[model samples]
Target: MKISNETIIEMYEKMVKIRKFETRAMNLFAEGQVGGFVHLYIGEEAVATGACESLRDDDYITSTHRGHGHILAKGGDMKYMMAELFGKETGYCKGKGGSMHIADATKGILGANGIVGAGHNIATGAGLGIQYKGTDQVCACFFGDASTNQSTFHEGLNLASTWKLPVVFICENNGYGISVSQARHQNITDISQRAVSYNIPGITVDGNDVFAVFEAVQEAVARARKGQGPTLIECKTYRWRGHFEGDPTVYRPEGELEQWKKKDPIPRVEKYILDNQVMTQAEMDKLNEKIDALVEEAVDFALASKFPDISSAVEDVYTDIVEEGRSR
Candidate 1:
């Protein structure tokens, strides 16, 4: 299917939002405005934008620790996300979950988990729900390349394939798991090839190219909605920042970060927009200004929101069990 110019504009806006949000997050984390660990989605904007663009609002997605981009791409509210980061009462999780655990059930975002590779389980379960309900809905599972080595990854794929579940496994191959590079940690060069073991379609694409990602995911999502089962898509991209905000990224090879920056997804899309006359530079300028204002408002909202009360720590902990004789 041919992508429309309007969708291209939407993709550009989403990519810019991801970039600006991450940049703001970095500054806020440095100033101690955001508590707890934060994993910035600085360079992998295209993957989330492209994949989520192919999905419907009723479809589900499971996110990782490095998940702000995924949630935002899937229509999460910036005000709520910012508030969550600020540990304020207005947050998505009532300010308790912090950076790694934001969720919006209405948006079909299961949650951004803190544990590595945990999303595989949640996404597979969501796929099961879709199958059981006899619905055409599909689940998109987003994870880092490193998580593919975990038991959950294997188990999720096996079960999804066995049941012919509607799940799309998306691996953002940013080439690092905390300080460890992909070459140093994993044996396989192409993680997508692992899909062969479960008899599913698998493919690798340039994660920086939003169009490539959109096309690939669109096809997979169509297949999934048609009950054709799962597809494993590995997006070869890079993270611009360290694993978390505080860590020194000295483990990265010299000039490596810069080289990846040269392939930065945001600018590439911008160039395409201009080159193809999809939109003029002036229109893009207006779009940037609009995004800038939106981000600023989100920051202001977070700043203005009140912090969560101390007594509310255990409020949403469980559904059925009461806390030490407290009422359910």
Candidate 2:
């Protein structure tokens, strides 16, 4: 599949945005400006950026805990995300849902899941809804390698396959399920192989290659839109940071992360752009400066935003039972 130069540049920009956002979030966490468990998607930017580029604005996506990258790629505003991290009322969830639970329904983001493999069922249900409505919409579900072990994964895949639901299961096999390495957690080398039982197309790709990921997902999205069953795409990538911020990552071998850094997706894309003469070095530099400023502005916006008022704690939480009874 031939991707246009414009699409490639956009994908590169999105990858850089994810890198910058996560880098800022990391520093903020260390400086005590942000709270809660923050999982950084430093090394896995390509997977999200490429996959999201293949999706339409009306298409749906379900993200995992390390979801900031996914949301941003799917057109999430950095200002609102930064506010949510700061627990400000101006956030997407009104300062209620933190790092792992941001959602933008208007943009087709079905919320990031805190529970492992929970997106499987949610994406399946969304696919079912699309099928019922007879729309060409498809839901792309993102999860980690270890999440495949969860019961929801099997159940969701089985049901979606049986019904030929328009869902795409994207497994980001980032080598570890939290602290446990892939070899330790699951015996299978390729998580995509799991799709065999469900009789769906299963593919494993180099997650670090943005174009490769884009092509694979574009094909899968097309298939889903055509009413075919879900496709399992295992992106074999690695996360530079620990499972969450402040995690020392003592479990990893000393040289493993350093080795993965050699294959950094951002640099790879940069090299492609320069080699192809797609953008001059000066243009790239200007783009970087612009992204840096945008991220800084988002930080400023979050800091200036107010926190959610304590009095309204139960406002969006429960139904107004008294009002409902009176009305009835």
Candidate 3:
């Protein structure tokens, strides 16, 4: 898929928004608003932006705990996402799902999974649904490097491959899977190479380059739509924040995190925008200013939003078994 100038600009804006959202959410976490495990996507904006840009609006995507980027790139509402992170009543899950579980099914985002590799099966099922319904919609499941070790990853990959389900298993290899480095966990250097076992094509791309990811994922989506089976894409990316808020990060070696920070996806995309003349610096600045304002408004909306009521703890919990005549 050839990317036009507008698409490039859109990609840049999406990456910028992810960076801003993650940074602001960190501040809210410190302020005691954002709840649960907060995994910021500071250095890995390009992977989500690029891969999602290649997808259609109606396509299905499953996300990881560090999923704010994937959700935002897949067209999730910023205000509602902010509310969810804040655990407010206006959240996507009405203050229940929190950081790791934010989702918007209508936008084709299945959900973000807290359990490692659980989303793989979900995307596989969604792919089967699309196939049964005879739709071109594909499922993109974004997971971590550590999840590649899970049995479900293999099971999901084999199931989709054997059935020829249209699913893209995107492994965002951000070096560490909650403090355990990829080197210590997996013997194979690149997780994409595992695709050989399932007889599916696997490719490792520079996750720092949004264009590279966009091009690679575009081909995979096309192949899936044409009845080709799933492809395992291992994106070599990095994150700037600790796994969660308050993580001591003792597992990280000295100067490693700093080195990855220098390869920030935001600046890389910005440089591409400038070098290609996709947008002038002034226009890019205006775009950033608009995104910043929108992010601020989202934060205010989340702050002003109410928390879910305590009396309704069991209201939606067992709706199926409860009688419909009961009043709120």
Candidate 4:
């Protein structure tokens, strides 16, 4: 449980990067620079940072629609992500997959799914593959609380548990499925309790605390690497933004967001660093300035990049299209 100072600093940097990136993305969306539905991961930075920090570069992860944080935490390049947001050809998916569908197999990021609960089955499959190969690798599945209601959640968890697949299910209980609050959507308060049905270890942790999340996921990951099977970790967090950009969020009670804002994960980590003397105030300020400049550079790069040529639209779409055409 001894985390190195380097790792802690890295985690802090990633959290700051996510916050700055999402904030800039919000502004870009408001300015109409980004197209399509954009989900901002503003308040829940700690969960993704802590979880991904516990994983190796070769470890697999499946992302949700609100996935920029997950991708960035897993070492995704900001330039490519920003380019994809801008729909430029230099994007991760060559501009075809925008915010919701970016993927980097080299980094073990299967891709971010637009469909709710889609990552569950994908992570299970990846776990099964690792089991077949007899590797010590594990797959971490990230999803929202509402996704647990989907059939894929039950099916994936059940199969992974029964087969002892190496997968760690990370549920980010953000307290709402779009506008419907957690109380309205599910009867249970703690989503981790559902793991009993699958016969796997389940625990709930304060997602706002970076170290808490890191410790929980790190243990789960170690268990999986030992071929012990999967675990369910419920992160009780909150999203400061609406489900997506431009949502009025009328269903939320007055002052609810402000209350959650009081527990904002980025500031919590900043306070921890300062209190623990992990970094001097001057060092922290310099880190923040560097991250801000990096995010700004990403925006500039995306804007300067060219859009995909219309003629090349069908190029990467269908793998067998050329063969089929030749046969015809």
Candidate 5:
């Protein structure tokens, strides 16, 4: 499917936004401006950009720990995200949930989970909701390679398949699950093959190629809207940073990082934009400037925002529970 130039430009912008946000996040975490651990989505930009681009505003997605890219691509507000990372009252979860738990229900982003393979059940549940509501909406579940081994992965896929839930399982096989490589952990070469058990369409594509991902997901979303069932899309990509920001990644093979760096998705997409003349260099530069200013503004907003009041700590935990001794 030929995506429009406008959409392509928007995709490019989203990819850049993810790159810039994570890059800044790395710095902020190091400088102690942001608390908690941060997992950078430095090289895996295309998968989220392409997949989310095919989604509508009401469509749902469950994100992984390395989920800033998914949220940004799905129209998450940067200021709120920055504030969340800064643990300010203006955050998405009012400073209660940190980086790995940022959620925007209005935007259909369920939440970025810290637990491995936790999103599978959530995405399937969202799909069930869509089916029950008789809506054309679908949920894209983004997970890492290691998540495929989790019991939730099997259980969720089984139920979704049996019920014909409209959930697209997007596995980002970045070669490593925390510190373990795919070869050392799993015997299967392609994680997509797991879908065979569920009798769903499973395919692997170059996660670095946004077009490949977009077209594949477009087809899957079409099939889902027609009540066809779920699809498993394994995106073979790499994570530039270690599992978390501070991980030295000693387990990585010599020169492996350099090898994957050659496949960086952002530069390749930028090249595609230039080759297609989707926008002139001047226009692209203007877009970059706009995104840069936006990131800076988000940082400023987070810095200026006040921390949540002490009473707010006990507020959002349970639906209706209140602290016995605490008075508001």
Candidate 6:
């Protein structure tokens, strides 16, 4: 938990970036600039930011469907993210992967899977790779509470723990798995508490509190890289948006949404940074303006980028071409 003033400032900026990016992307989606399900990671910024602050440049991370926050926190580029959302050819996957399947290898972001809990196994496999290669790099897998019910969640954690793999299992219990409340989903109130069964240390943190999440992750990651074992960190947070872009969420309770809104990570981190003298308020304002302008430019770039030609629509099907060749 030895976080310096510099690290706090970076975390604050990253949380702000996530909120603004999600907000702008929602507006663009409404304007018809994007297609497919756009699940905004508006409320869960601090979870990704805080957890990933513990990772290094070479450390890998896998993301869930609602994963813009993880990608940004893991140092993903805004221009490519915007382009991918817009379905432009300049996207991370050259516009093939869309909103849910964004992957940036250069940043060590393995990918964001559309399927629930898919990234869990992928992250486990990555930890195995790290173990095999004898690298000190760690892997952080971001999954929602709904994903915990999925088989991969069990399989991945079991494998990671058995092998004592260097992986951080982050469960973002945002209180809902697309309209199903935590009360309805699991009997256990604290998802982190389940780590005891796996023989790994688990911690529950206020996901809205960026510093707390960051500190907890720092410890878990240090332990992981030391080859001790994986850690299960359940971040108690909320998603500001609906399950997807077009769902009018009549499912959520009235005051609960407003209650979580009071815990917005951006302002909380901003105030913490300023009040702690980590950075001046003027500097924070200037940084925000810079980030906003960068996002705006990314949007424009995405709009101006070329679309993938229809001729190659089926070109990326690897097995199809292999099967055709085998027929010869």
Clashes of each: 0, 0, 0, 0, 0, 0
Candidate No. with top TM-score: 5
Predictions in order: lDDT: 0.94, 0.94, 0.90, 0.95, 0.93, 0.90
| Candidate 2 lDDT by residue in tens digits, 152-186 | 99999999999999999998999999999999998
lDDT tens readout by residue for model 6, 87-139: 88899888888989899888899999999999889999999999999878999
Every model's TM-score: 0.97, 0.97, 0.96, 0.97, 0.98, 0.95
Candidate 4 — what's its lDDT? 0.95
Query: What value does the lDDT take at residue 291 in candidate 4?
Result: 97
The residue pairs found clashing in candidate 3 are none
- Candidate 4 off by > 4 Å: 322-328
Give the CA lDDT, 0 to 100, for residue 75 in model 3.
Answer: 97
Query: 1-328, model 4: which lDDT tens digit per residue?
Result: 7777788899999999999999999999999989799999999999999999989999999999999999999999999999999999999998999999999999999999999999999999999999999999999999999999999999999999999999999999999999889999999999999999999999999999889999999999999999999999999999999999999999989999999999988888778788888999999999999999999999999999999977657676567662222222
Give per-residue CA lDDT, model 1, range 196-284, as digits (tens): 99999999999999999999999999999999999999999999999999889999999999999999999999999999999999999
Model 4 clash pairs are none
Model 1: residues with Cα > 4 Å off, grouped in runs: 320-328
Candidate 3 C-alpha lDDT tens digits along 83-130: 999889999989889989988989998888899999989899999999
Tens-place lDDT per residue, model 5, 1-328, is 6789988999999999998999999999888788788988999999999999889999999999998999999999999999999999998889988898989999999999999999999999999999999999999999999999999999999999999999999999999999999998899999999989999999999999999999999989989989999999999999999999889999998999999999999889888889999988899899999999999999999999999989877675688996654654
How big is the positional error of residue 11 in model 5, measured in Å on the Cα after superposition? 0.2
TM-score of 1: 0.97
Can you list the residue pairs that collide in candidate 1?
none
Candidate 6 segments exceeding 4 Å error = 319-328
